[model samples]
Target: MSESKDFLRSIVEEDLKSGKYKEVITRFPPEPNGFPHIGHAKSICINFGIASDYNGHCNLRMDDTNPTKEETKYVEALKDAVQWLGFDWGKNVYYTSDYFQKIYNYAVELIKMGKAYVDSVDEEQMREYRGTVTEAGKRSEYANRTVEENLELFEKMKNGEFKDGEHVLRAKIDMGAANMKLRDPLLYRIRHVNHHRTGDEWSIYPMYDFAHCLSDYIEGVTHSICTLEFENNRDIYNWVLDTLGLELPRPYQHEFARLGINYTVMSKRKLLELVEEGKVSGWDDPRMPTIAGYKRRGYTKESILNFCDQIGIAKANSMVDVAQLEFCIRDDLNTKVPRVLTVLDPLKVTIVNYEGSEVIDAPYYPHDVPKEGSRDIPFSNEIYIERDDFNENPPKGYFRLTPEQPVRLRHGFIISCKEVIKDETGKVVELKVEYHADSKSGSDTSGIKVKSAIQWVSAKEAIKAEVRVYDRLYANEAPESLEDLNSSSLTVIKDALIEPAIVTEKIDERFQFERQGYFYADPIDYTDEKPVFNKIVGLKDSWGKKTAPKQESKTESKKQAKNEQVVGTEVAMSDEQQALFDKYTSELKLNAEVSNIIARDEKLSSFYADALAELNSPVGIANIVVTEVARELKEKEANELNFTAKQVSQLVKMVDDKTISSKIAKQVFEEMVKSGDNPDKIVEAKGLVQISDPSVISPIIAEVIEKNPDNVEKFKAGNNKLLGFFVGQVLKATGGKANPQVVNKLVAQALK
Candidate 1:
């Protein structure tokens, strides 16, 4: 599916060209102990994807060596995850437990060759005997046992004559080996647990190291690809196969880094705990990182596959921004799913002047989407809009409805608020609006202009639904405990309203729910009487909006992957460039990765150097130069730029001196780009001074807290991610003039 070759694929391609084997064979061997997460998805894509690319076969193998932990349900889940990701394991599914007899026979042969022995050390004693990284272990006295004696004891042990921990089989490898795994590692462990497949047929089960290589050889696997954690175990993998004098075309293991996304956990133990402890509904909980979770949440197979391909393969472990995954889903659904109007938080509206109801034809997809199909959308005097669409005290850039402002109902008439109706509690329950008779979408004569069109559903014909909005599982970017679980990860809107065509027409299982996000009908729970839609992902890159200096809009984050993600075309640095990189990292204290990217681009490097000369704030100056200034320098030389490097330094100085926030600096930079004005003048004219005064920002934070009681509860319940939400809201309220640092402190305190 991809043109260029990763390291693993390169190996397979070379092996085939060199006639190393007649056909390439790979296997995805997951231990059936827990559900597979996104990490396993990466491995499955690699092993099965390479096989498909090379016209080979990939066997789906279950490495069920630990009977105590293995289960049949987990095996099925693993199989389902692979198939759901759109891959097939040719022929029959393979299980390592099926080869227990053969593996035991190989162990017997090793004993006959005086290369194996049975050790009778307790658990703590075994650890002590294995020695440390620096020290070498002494050979056990049992290593000197006769081959016949060892064979008898091994047979007796297998015959269930020994207790669970009485004895164990170990390869008589180098006891003094530096690699701890090679220091006569255990070939078999004693476990009285019932086997999921073999049942109680035998008391002995071969360990993973003793069985995996043999299973691969027995199945004629050519390339054994695995994650980096198994790199050290490769020696044992090879030692077992080579020492046995296995047939040619034996599998050779290759390692690649596993997938790791921030704000999520991939450990099976952690995931299992999440399921077993009822932290989530199940392993298939949409908030979990499991493959079934993603599928249940409405993510398409194409999106997950594209994510794996776009992230590419790497040799070193790295934490990917979850935003990359979000971008992939949005990109996939942008042109594929139908755009339907669904309001999660509905606000009722009554058109006072409009008299009659009519059905207007609305395209299922926007004009940008290539597909063409329209559904009947009922337009009535009474309709429901998103509660967030209307504001009593509208902000500076508020485009939705307000008392003094008019908004167009999507696919319907333009309406202005004539009155606001409230309940006894003083909450605005409904809006009495008057509509422009000729201002309907697609054809208008009254010449009315509204700020923006808001999604609405006819109160008479709208379908009621349960929309489950799922957020990330962890509050912390790098989670360390169960306490990091996001309490507000799942928000269920039981009374969500949607247009009739969504349920009656049923164009697709997945849909872009207008301004909300992409959603999928709950396969297990959806019914004609009760429709349950789970939000797959938001419309934009949420992690970006939350992490950026200011909240980025959908249009701003439209091509985040295109702008932020790039192939590491890290050209070999010249001596002069290397010196610059070294100085930037050591003397200037610039981030090494950021410095590397800038140092490689000649125009960016020159501009960065000039900016650095103007200001001693290496980090701040380098940031603006590489990001904003570099954006201009990309298509034009530094000399052709409107703003000079000195202007960039001045912008950084304003941010450093607390005269402006980084968010304000960004605005000032944009102004400089447009008019080549000094940042100081831009800040002065716009009155964009940093609001460091706690007196001003604290009240704003208090108002945000009052407005978002749900988020306030979430923050108190360990959902630290909501702190950004509160901060972004305050900043928006202040028209980006609030000091983010003060807002952050005040919000945390208010929420607490």
Candidate 2:
């Protein structure tokens, strides 16, 4: 895959091309107030990725401006996270406190130049006078102090002559400026607490707004990248740099959208709440959105970088679906990880035709994944398969282990369920199956064929281990306010049976537990006596199309290709199907394709007709039913899916009303196929509603233009094709839910 330069990287490319700076220098300045989350990971990648691409030095700076919440522990953890993400800061690692003297000297320079002043107002009075955006701020009584008087007070603040919050240094910027951040923001505050690294040398600490810009100046940084929330602060960032008269190559501030993934809160405060409330185990809990949590959960560092790259830099905030992240991990590990058999929910099976234990050589890697090695798996008369794989009273389309039905044992022989044994409560305890002697894998001669083939482990030799499964941390797609935190995010299967090979693997090993999901040997909990595994991601996407199964050659593969399910009602369509059959055959005057489909089953035909009847669009509904619905029915019956006829009406209505473009509607409908949820609920839950309203979309467009100034200029200079690029950017910002017509019009207006 080719790498696409993000807006930030594009800026670097232009600077390099235009000779704006000899070399690019960026920094990842984390505050060390809390553990790093996925949002911070994006920042780290952006900063380091740019510097590496430009062949320039990158700095890992600790912006420990506040001593109250800062600690050495967090500093160490942050460093570990950056290093684990595969970034080397080299020898340029720095701290803002390291330049305390220089920052203090710059503050004195500001005071001598009358650009900064000391204020004796109390904290309450200070905030009261700072005023809202609509109201102009009132100047402090102490703001008009003489330059010598202000200098004396500032020195006193540093020497502990003033108590905490008694006196502070404030910049002399406009008190009534329209941009609130420029309204004489505080330069320094009195903090009597001892610093973590500097100790009790100074009683006052520089505020972040003041220390950040000056530190960048002192370090000669070329560009300072921040999240969108800091865009308003950029004015103050420049005010400080210009007021201090910093030399050339002064750092320029740029803002990009921060990553806010669905199902997890990126706010440090909220993540801390989860840890403090016992909602999760700790910061490193596998369910946490923290980088450490991801590491503990078996996610590769490369996968995180890949995910960050996939979601490139944007100017407007949007919630990315968590499934995309899951896809990255699954894709990263798919071909590289070995395959194994693990029964999560076990059911006992007894082979009546087999007398003793027989060893079968099973390839450790699937044919799609190229690797050599086979493990001798001992198969006995008794073994275990997944409990859900068997059915006493089979459903209409159940294919696995019904009574008297033969199913192939993975890498073993074909077995037929002869009898099902039950305990006193009539609960099934064991299945008695007869195995065909000639049906052994690789040498099968039996002409019999079965639709189901399942993975199993020998009951006598299988290793017992605990497998921890994880779901999304929050039930809501956008947990903006912790609206719906999922209570059952973690599940532990205590008696999972795995092949013996899994027990001896290394701690960092990952494997595909056939039919289950990709799992990792729990690095923190694995033991030789009792192994533990963590489920990284499931094989099947619950919110989209089913991942295509691994392709297998019919000559060497034991698994059967999927076949369309036959409806149980063979004689006639049900009453529901009959009514739809009559409608399509007579009044609607549809073709044989519609009539033949509706004649297959009463309920299914009714489902198709109901969708068409509600939408009153035959061709559209017919294509959807013949294609999407038919494809889904291979795995489950029409009635078994969560999809409803009414949702189809809603989906078609979206296309008709232009609520969603045809492209986005297809995505919505596909999600409906996977989850069987309503289109409206899916749209609302996933933040997929179109942004046709100008008030909602104009700011996004303006920001996109502001971020990609070069591109906007080129578009204005006769590059009409860039119009599609801008439209695509808006679509991405809105998660592909923006109406194209509105976006095209608004983008043209903004460009003009």
Candidate 3:
């Protein structure tokens, strides 16, 4: 498809083609009162994206009419965020403060032309006159003020002749118009406060309605793109331009829908509240929807742009699923991040029979990646595997390690559990396993076929890293509707043991722990020795587990068992127990056949069986099969679901694994469904694999240096700003495949 014809572009194109305007000019006029958020990013992208597509100029104009809230800090952050998103306003940067003199002159001219007048009404009285949406507002008593008197009062208001909000200048528009914005809206407000840029030069500032259109005209902006909220204001935008009688290209306003996502509050006021109330760390909090927040959280500009493209422009407002946003992140990250292993929740496993002196070389990427490079990762008698991998009494259809089952220690040897060591609290402290020396990884002679391969990090070379496991900021999909403000959903796991490779100088890189999800070094908090990593998004979808019906079923089953015992002595059931039984019986009546089918499936683990019985909804299973499984199959473009019905059914059986988040998992499943690829392979190829291993990525740093000589030279030439350039080059070289934090550290080392 051609890039020059987005919806807004098409409008501009039609306008230009029809000779409505000889040249197309646009402006991104941000109110410099607050930092730009992700919502603003969409506007920036739309405005600049359209202007660039149409070969037009876009002015970066600051709508600083509200000097009470506007600040230079916000202006700088806005500029940075726009540039970071890869758009340029060139030399057309402007401020409304720059046109204060002109705007004041225009207001005076309007008063002289009997198009404006001085109003003595207070703020409350003004609102009373500017009636409700359905009612016509009462005309101001001062509406018919003579031009000479109106102009004189307006000048007095500008010359600090009155206190703020005492007397104001209003446009002499109709008060009975259906659109309330045109009801003699204030052209200028009396504010004695010092302006951030203009200082105490004037007392009156032009209102948004009056100054915005005039500023656009002064800059010769041909098209003024704004959100749909301004649709009604379009009339006024044109009025100010037409009244000026300016022969310049008067800008036409086009409105597009503002982007909104589920579970997110996009209002700048609410976002600021989040920051001020300490709900989030700052504006750049990964949990925040701000552009800076996303950048800090390891999102790429390309991914954000791609998401905008997928959502497309719409004339009406709509809410986009947060899953789609995550999908784009995973899609971009997967293609670019490299695969590595780092255990977040660590449990020690002793290979009892293996010699303590043993160490092996593991290739950073798969053998197919470079085909020649491999780094030595120390392997010994002791290693740490995920605690969830082992089950004392193995459940039905469980394929991971158990009492007698042998499992492959990824990139190492096959090990069989011989003993489970427990601490004083009776918790399994460690696992004693015996390894087959002959069954080394990459050696087929051992002839060992295990049911599953578990990932591990050697305890001897492990790095004590802080791993932050981030969940959704809100527990509810529609958090804005909820009244409770205390429901925080973020969990930070600080004590995580990772591979020694992770402890290397490349602390800022992202690494995919094999069988785990993607993770990135927390750039703001991480250091070379004690790296802190944030779980960008998990490898799987676990949201269903928290809200799954299994808990209710367990409670119901227990209640039934207790009621039956009580009824042995007494004949009547309590109201609550009877209600529970009735509900259960009703469910059985509704889905007996599907429930029977699930009960008869011997291959399904007890966990899933209970979940199915509790859920008692065939629709749940059907959704899992169709939406989750089938969708995954389609994403992977598989000929058939080859993993197995047991494997497919087991998804519901086990509590949702925390390897990947539900958001990330849904995205991964979508990719799998479309491509017919294994989850690991899909994740590896796409950089969706979370990096938990430091050792594996430490060496990938060397490879990044070998690949980018230009960036290395730039870094050494004292152009430190080129650090991001190097990071971008590394990411580009890896196809967004390498962990960026690791790339940053490694690039720094190579340059030094």
Candidate 4:
């Protein structure tokens, strides 16, 4: 495989070289149940990206099988998302509904071959018959029906003779096989609901596993690519084709990790709920993670594509920190957008020593940017500066305007605060400042040095505009529910002051609001009468920790880490604790370190014991109790905990089942702490299921490596100590959700 090509591209290139069909045809098959999000964007990029790279063609297909929820609006949304990302789906868009007849014909073929049966068992009974993972599923007695009888029942189902769930056509793949999906998986089910496209033409719809492969076959899709969650379905994908004696060189299934961003929900159901529940304005709410949301929020298509390119493709699934995403917008807009003055929280500043107004010619683009555009910024004696720019009693490293510090009004003359005016509430409402007449921006003669230039708008010429400052929508990095909806997500500065040039002159839609954030002219709300601007993104600090205060000071944390030792610490455990730890490690197979931490505390041990009683998972239970439950226990007694042992046990079971990752379990645990909600409900509510198929983490890992080349070179030079640093970097990038094992292995190989 070429170094530049990802695994999917590699597959495409090899297939084309081997003459596995002349063209590399792929499809972006999205079910139109909800608006497409960035996850869909990744799929769009991949399917179209592969096709484009190989000089092939990709078809935009709507797998609109489930008519219960699918809507024309969602279908239009899917199309919009694809086109907005700058891709063409050829002349005709495909719909699975269009091939219903062909799909039904294939099902009839399966029945004629005695490979499928019409099962009359109820939905509940079918589930029970599917059985547990360890135990083999039992075939329904209805499976004993002859092929002719089954065909009659299926025809009845299609003719709308059967009610919903009365009967389902199941593939006769396997009953005692370990892969339970093949345990007579449903080929088709009768749904009386109306399909968006098909209308009342068909009452029975083919299952995803049934229709997907056949659709790919009919479409001549060379490579059937999907997210890792469908890895098991690949078995069925091939089985249907192999059983049917389909044409040679049929599409082969391949899986890639789906994109998952921290602090956002990607599940279409959850997103739909958010839209329906009025938590957001709509699917296109600027705060939503949907492609339309990002577009409405002023994210350029180029930036979105660049982010997809930067994140790259990976094989393992993991949570990606939203900081990396935020960084992408900042990086993209830094050079492309213009700079303008806008005060979010205006504090009136009067140049007491100044006389008249003046027009200051300031270039819209910063000095570093190569764009050529300048606007005459109106400056006068009365101006409005950001309230934050003037701290009455400044901090030690304060740089902006204060009683003592002198600052330059960006593109205008330097000013010194002479007097502070306050209202009855003691809030600094205004500032009286003196300006240096000769210290104009272009021709400065004053020898005084200022730390920074703050943005300001002339009170007389300032346009009254509403600036909506947007923050991360979810309060928790892994959102739990409406409870996690950030209260400060949308803060509207109704009367923010901006330089008149933006309103008067013909300027670009997006602009960097001087010291605040990238601002977009609100496409839906901006007008001459009522100017509105949406904050696209804030200027990211170097490390991107919410533009944190003193978080960049890693010295103390490093010193503490060196003292405690990252490998292991000599944790003091009682004799009773020691004995418990020994039993946990030796008998229960718990990690020695986790066992030690849990056993060291009587309350934790008690909680751990109760959880163990509920579910006999020693390692999983002990890990959470030690790291997470223990922390909560540190501040409160066990009885005071919001959650119970049984809840913790259920959480561990989810981890054991790979339903959620251990890192995600921590998130669920936090929500559990707040509301004492059951772990399962929390997971479902938050859509906290882990997305395996790790390729999404690859680009982030590469980024972490690139940002710390010194550590990379050191690791290559045999300083093995840096391995933890690299792992930590990756973990931090993933909000501690990237598989540590994967990170350790990937980092080691990359450094080599």
Candidate 5:
């Protein structure tokens, strides 16, 4: 472990350096009354991360002070979740109940010291005595009780001599203190309910405030890092330690803002209500913000940790854009997860020209990644493509399949749509297509080009699977603002067909369906024959529709005039006009402000018309000119923007190789916006290159191990923590020249 000098770490470092304590210790005390959420992840990471980084020890303590709400089941689940997050509590695991006798003796000691007494004030009376922010509270009549009498009463109350809520032990602190928590807070209360761990032995329990500070002192914790809400309670925390004259360690408290996303209510109580009221499936529902939920939804722990790091500990409360979280997951999954194709909404397509009994063995990965062997996918004359891929009446900029339009069938041959096969209801049931044998993907033939390449699965070899395409649980960015009891935001698509290649032994694994986005195997519902996958998050935010300009040709205008005269009414707008209308309607939505409410609305319509009137291109205006642009000007934090719609769309385009590689595109994108320059110009000036060549990375890895002799020795000595140090030094040596994947593999081999 190394010395940490961050705000919280600095406190610990100063304490240790000044001989405040011989050794450092910390505790991650969670109340085991409910399942932990992403907010809890921050506390877990901070406590355990700091301890590990500083060579200190962290205790996984359950503050099960409230017997009525706490349970053994919750305790077990919490422990399992903490371990799953890749943290160990070591040998210092404890419960507040474990120190019941010790805490009782401390309370008796306080009573004898004239610092605490048993009070008969009921709940309502006690609340009244604990005055508001502007006023001071009056002392209770029991505040000056004799030590002999207080001790006798406290013992009897604990021995079942008093009914529940009749008597409580309270500290004799100043009622005039500005902080409400120090106004003679309750130390112990009579609870007749049976305890989960210590059954029937005692009828009283300690409150959180009383138990927490003392637990830290008893365990010799150096720092008590907690969320910002507990900032005001620091006074009472220190008072308890100071009055007792105990051998307290550093135990200095530091507050960090809790993690709050745009569309989430991080409150444990509200989350529980959502689970109980059937708004979500369970604690592990893919839509939930719980760690288990995220894990099931294909979010890697590394991604989560990176996200926490990016949204560093701050003093002020801030709402982190959910896009940042998604970005973290995408960045992590993109490198590790293998790509595959699966169609959710299928429309059958038959190649009339192609001969029968033909099969193609298409390679899976475009770039060779070690350990991920290729699979043979059967391609026949018939296949299923996305229903939305084809349109009967094509509009301008519609690049996908249409009448007489040629499109590449992913890894198969280039095909042209000849005719549409329809049912009696005028619904398109199938498409008749002709394939060019010379334009087979692997065959080197000239003059083969298409505007669109659509994904497909062979109808004969396709596997029937349940693909749960999950969207935002609420249509609104902030669903918590909805007052309706039935305003649930989740939708589930039950049936889907996927390529057989995806059904290998790693069917339980997660993969990106190329253009479709990321998905995870449903652990509960998936089977060998029928796989079920849940859409974790989309490749890009595809919530809104694209609008095209209306066409008014001379021939159509004459027919429209005749129809208008017959009904004495003007003809309604065309499909393009209606699309524009819908877009405007979307921009007008007055939903809650979580993400970019204004930009999301603007994206819904032709509001860009007004925007473009003041700018050059409507597309450019829509992308680069918005409230977010202004927000970046004011705050300089791109993450604090209300919406990331433009950034997300650009990222998708970059990945598709429209302009530059994703790595360079990201760097240029950030710089262009910050410096107010053209993206293309910035890319040229910086000469930011994406290192895809593995040959260049091999030597750099060897050099990195040679340079960091100490870290190399540590790695060989079973100090796996130093592996990251080697990676960092390798990245630095190359000036980030080496490809990370190649460097990781080469370094692992060198160490072995």
Candidate 6:
């Protein structure tokens, strides 16, 4: 939001600071041949943002010069995408067709000045004559046509005397120019195709290189901004503007790096191919990188703009991790959207002790999100939970429903599984449980506790919906170059169950589906009769395991203790390690283990200092630096991380402040390590945050209690040693950061 630090902005700022331009004016010119993608979003922000910051104006110019590829549909889609990004062009919207006559007059003036001529080279011959980057082009024989003859021929060409590609107008610049773009580029091409806007008014259309610069000049665009691909075209841009002897203060072209996302190809041609071939549903397919695609996928306008801002304009070309973009949207939605519960793979649970149904009042703002509202969801003896929530033969650390484990029914009471009913095929058909009669969510008299609480929808009140989970369209980093694509990008679940409130919610509303992921009503498919929702992203990075404390055996501890000061025992320490170690331990108050590991590396020390600068919490950062960062540094050098110390510090602070759990932090840290990206970005991109608010965590814990009846019995029968085991289970179930103190107290009360 502050003055942009991008190279393009620096020039604009210098121009503004100086009296060169009274007011800045810029334009977002799209060819209107295809739908705009995330690449255009960056340009829109740059051009429009600069103009806005300087109190100037920006024009939305649809470059409909080549009407053969342009269409009314594309123009509308472009406008919709711009508006969806929360920008307005006001009365500054214009089309290249609007300036056809003016540009024609400029071309005529060039003919008069003998700076242009008519050429009759065929398309194939022109390609042969137009030399490569390393070669000088051969001049066309028709380049020397007399000005009077050229003017007459041009008039005849415009009058429809020339067939398509039979004749062309060429600038008379040097043929031997090193820049092929400047080697007498074609100023106009004869095309008999009717224009989308002009409609047969002229047989010839001015080329983009000729029309673009002139359009900017005509509209008083002070700064003509484009992507790096157009850098070579700037020479011809200036030549046309200068050759016509245009008025003073002509628009100057500036280029910056375009947005390139991993696993996303922004080529309009490729994207169109995908749509036409049914590789994707349409241009607005949530998997596509197009602006419309993101909008339909529950990505907020604020998030896209934030993403553009974070990946600010640069001159150099680079591939940005898509996680950065995801982070932006997730961060924006986190505190604003309410949380909801939906089960994609439903498994029925029968509470044997409860006879009838009841209504539980649950806060819509159960999570950390700052919201206010409550919804009455039906709670009955019969409910549908996620199929994966129950495991008959549970893993060692599994915290959800087991054969004899008690778990809490979120927003209701604690329940323990009494029996597991299976079909003939051995698939879990139903789970019979008994609920703690007095353990109501609020104002409970029955002492009950849980390690995990699983969400469930009342079987009687459940709403059936089709849920679509979308993943990266391309599994490879650069799918543009690779032939292989991710064929399984979209997975459709036909029988997901949602609470009653989801049916009444408006389209495009975002909600965290409890332990699942953030989802939104499909803008086009969602309906009252048969609802559809798209899983925007999962709660954690679905790609990896959650962060758990690394257990050390007594032998390993003894080994580490014996070689505490030995170099390269686990990692090589630098000569500066002692000083940094003392400083962090005594001055910064960081733990010994973390300081010992981090001080050995200059990059880690700098990262530590930077993180310390942003966050005052040393222990929080130390935990990550020692465990997560050290693990990464063991194999690679610090420079390879591609992240700054400030990013590390911010991530540490997020965990220290309990914005996300240590388990969730591990997921974020993994992404950061892989991409060398910012921690905040990884968290946002992956939705790796811990929900510690009582409203959300209480239900999850209750489910854990009810699912583990045998553990509860043991604790009650003088086996107090199971307390730590119960706490570990709760932590594991809740992604490892469940307000430990709160879970401990609740567990103690439940066993009482």
Candidate 2 local lDDT, 206-258, one digit each (tens) = 99899998888777788899999999999999999888777787899999999
4 versus 5: better lDDT goes to: 4
Clashing pairs in 4: 314-695, 315-693, 315-694, 315-695, 316-693, 316-694, 316-695, 317-693, 317-694
Q: Which stretches of model 2 miss by more than 4 angstroms? A: 1-4, 480-483, 505-508, 543-752
Q: Could you list the CA RMSD of all candidates, in the order they appear?
A: 19.8, 15.3, 12.9, 18.6, 9.9, 16.6
Candidate 4 weakest ten by summed lDDT: 564-573
Q: Who wins the lDDT comparison?
A: 1
CA lDDT, candidate 2, residue 4: 38
Off by over 4 Å in 1: 1-3, 544-752
Tens digits of per-residue lDDT, candidate 6, 1-752, equal 33115677788889988878988999999999999999999989988888876778999999998978989989999899888876779865799999999999999999999899999988899999988888888989998788889999999999999888899999999878988888889999888898888899989999999999999999999999988999999999999998888888889999898888877898988988899888888989999888888878888888888789767778888998786676566556655666677888888998898997778888776333345787888998899888877889875555667877877777788888899999999999998998888888776687654555678999988999998888778755567633546656788999999998877754237787876667888889888889888878654332211111237553564455455532111222344665676676556655333455567667667766766778887777766675567556656776676665677787777877777766677667666666888877676765656655777666766787797798788888999977876776777676565777677777677668
Error of 5 at 464 (Å): 0.5
Instruction: Give a tens-digit lDDT track for model 5, residues 637-730.
Output: 4444333445434433443443455334545656755665555556567654545466776677777677668767777889997677676566
Tens-place lDDT per residue, model 1, 1-752, is 32346888899989999999889899999999998989999999999988977879999999999999989999999999998887889669999988999999999999999999998878788888888889998777788889999999999988888899899999999978988899998998777778999888778889888899999999999999989999999999999999999879789999999999998999888898888898999989998888989888888888899789867899999998786787678667776888888888889999888788889998887543568998998888999998888989964656679999998887778899989999999999999999998887778897876656678999999999999988888756779779877666788989999888888989899988866677999989999689999988865443432332325543463444236521111123555665676677546756434566576678888888888889888888876775567657757987788899898898999999999987678778878988999999989998889887898888888887887797788788898877877887888788777788788788878877
| Selected candidate, larger lDDT, 1 vs 2 | 1
Q: Relative to the unseen true structure, what is the C-alpha lDDT of residue 427 in candidate 2, on a scale of 0 to 100?
A: 86
Quote the lDDT for 130 in model 5.
Answer: 88
* Ranking 1 against 6 by TM-score, winner: 6
TM-score for candidate 6, residues paired by index: 0.75
Cα TM-score per model: 0.74, 0.73, 0.74, 0.73, 0.77, 0.75
Worst 10 residues of 6 by lDDT: 540-549
Better of 1 and 5 by lDDT: 1
How close to the true structure is residue 120 of candidate 6, measured as C-alpha lDDT? 96
Model 2 — TM-score against the truth? 0.73
Top-TM-score candidate index: 5
Off by over 4 Å in 3: 1-4, 366-374, 481-488, 505-508, 544-752
